[model samples]
Target: MNAKSLVVIGIFGIATPALAAAPTIDQLIANPPLLNAEMDRCKHLGMAANDDPRCQTAWKAENKRFFGNGVRYSPEPVNIFRNTPDKLVPAEKQQPIPPAPAGAPHG
Candidate 1:
């Protein structure tokens, strides 16, 4: 009701969520952070934790849940190449190559 009570309530609300957001040892061990694409790819391969034994255990447990499971996933969420055959422009359609510079030997 009062400003002091309102402020205290608001502070507690924020603090409660902040506390919950903090990672527990169990969570940290189960889902170790991927430091880079290489690490993520390792996870994608079910490597779990190559460097950390704890993560390895967690990955083993997670892998067990998919016994006999055949995974179906795309390569990645990124541009695989500059252009594919369908998207490529033929050489003749492209701009002509610039003429060789003066005194420059032709290739």
Candidate 2:
């Protein structure tokens, strides 16, 4: 065989394994057993699932697998200023600023 043919064959051989290793979209869609198995495992753990590290990890991974790594929606709007004490307490509740000395320049 020509050197060019041999090079092409070698490249294909290297790439074939990589291509085979990746799961296709169809394969992923068809894989319900894993999801069901994980659900069963977590279900069996019940309330104790929260304390089980392995169960927690599996649940998190399953959630990400199904929901994807996207922004989550909440029924209630998130308060960005939740941790800020100033925002929580109204300005009126705070001590009023002392008035400037009489005849003092407004500037």
Candidate 3:
């Protein structure tokens, strides 16, 4: 084989082992139990897990599992706290002032 062919073959040989060792998408998606276990472990890791690629990937998988592929299905929001009243209250009637005391001085 030519030197170029040998070099190409060597690169593929090294990469094939690495690719085989890495998890496939099907493997990732098919094992929710394993993913849950991984998520628990990541959770226990606390703040450190934020910097971890494995935890990040696991979180992405979890989000996709729950939310689906970026599509949102949110329902219209209802106004539960609205202050609609069944009936309006009318203002109380005011009593007429009695004629000022007859002897009171006029302004």
Instruction: List RMSD in Å for every model shown.
Output: 19.4, 18.0, 10.1
User: Which runs of model 3 end up more than 4 angstroms from their true locations?
Assistant: 1-26, 73-107
- Residue 17's lDDT within candidate 2 is 75
Mind giving the per-residue lDDT tens digits that candidate 3 earns over 35-99? 88778989999999999877877887777777777637558655566795555698799999889
Q: Which candidate has the highest TM-score of all?
A: 3
Q: Best candidate, lDDT-wise?
A: 3
On the 0 to 100 scale, the lDDT of residue 80 in model 2 is 79
Candidate 2 lDDT tens digits, 1-107: 99999999999998777543433334443566755665687789889878866565566656667887677887777667766664454455668799986896678
lDDT of 1: 0.54
Ranking of all predicted structures according to TM-score, beginning with the best and ending with the worst = 3, 2, 1
Looking at model 3, the pairs that clash are: none
Query: How well does candidate 1 match the true structure in TM-score terms?
Result: 0.24
State how far residue 12 of model 2 sits from its true place (Å): 44
Candidate 1 C-alpha lDDT tens digits along 1-107: 99999999999988776533333334544554522333455566674357655445454544543342465666764566756653555575668789986996779
- Cα misplacement distance, residue 80 of candidate 1 (Å): 40
User: Each candidate's TM vs. the true structure?
Assistant: 0.24, 0.33, 0.43
